[model samples]
Target: MQHAIHPAYGPVVFRDKAADFAFLTRSTLGSDRTVEWEDGRTYPVVDVEISSASHPFHTGTARVLDAAGRVERFEWRYGREAA
Candidate 1:
């Protein structure tokens, strides 16, 4: 309820580089870069490295780790000593 104390909140475009995905949403984040959207409006564009679109879990391409093999290797080298 304060005046001129809050950050500007408006449309912001989030871009995912790996997945090549971009979406517009309201946010307080600001950027110097701008891009012309499909709606013929320019908004601040923010570049992101990863998101749900490109993440392995969301894409169903997550790699399963071999815990047994890692434990065997550790024991073989450390001789079961709790360090």
Candidate 2:
């Protein structure tokens, strides 16, 4: 653990606007935005597009691609040439 060589590690709030979720954790990243946490202290806030709360895979909202339909389209386009 070297002193004065490492970036400042402090509490930061990562906010997911889509999901309207925010969590506090230690980070070396800095932000100009700030938010008052539940502890009554202001912390640096970072906006994020997606998080586990809003991610399709995590929330089981992921759409499955139709491989059969794609195969059918490919066959319709190229199958006649081979025949």
* Model 1 bad stretches (over 4 Å): none
lDDT of 1 by residue, 15-35 (tens): 998898999999999999998
TM-score per candidate, chains pooled:
0.85, 0.81
For model 1, the run of ten residues with the poorest summed lDDT: 74-83
Model 1 TM: 0.85
lDDT of 2 by residue, 10-58 (tens): 9999999999999999999999989999999999999999999999999
Q: Could you tally the backbone clashes for each prediction?
A: 0, 0
Native-referenced Cα lDDT, model 1: 0.94
lDDT, candidates in the order shown: 0.94, 0.95
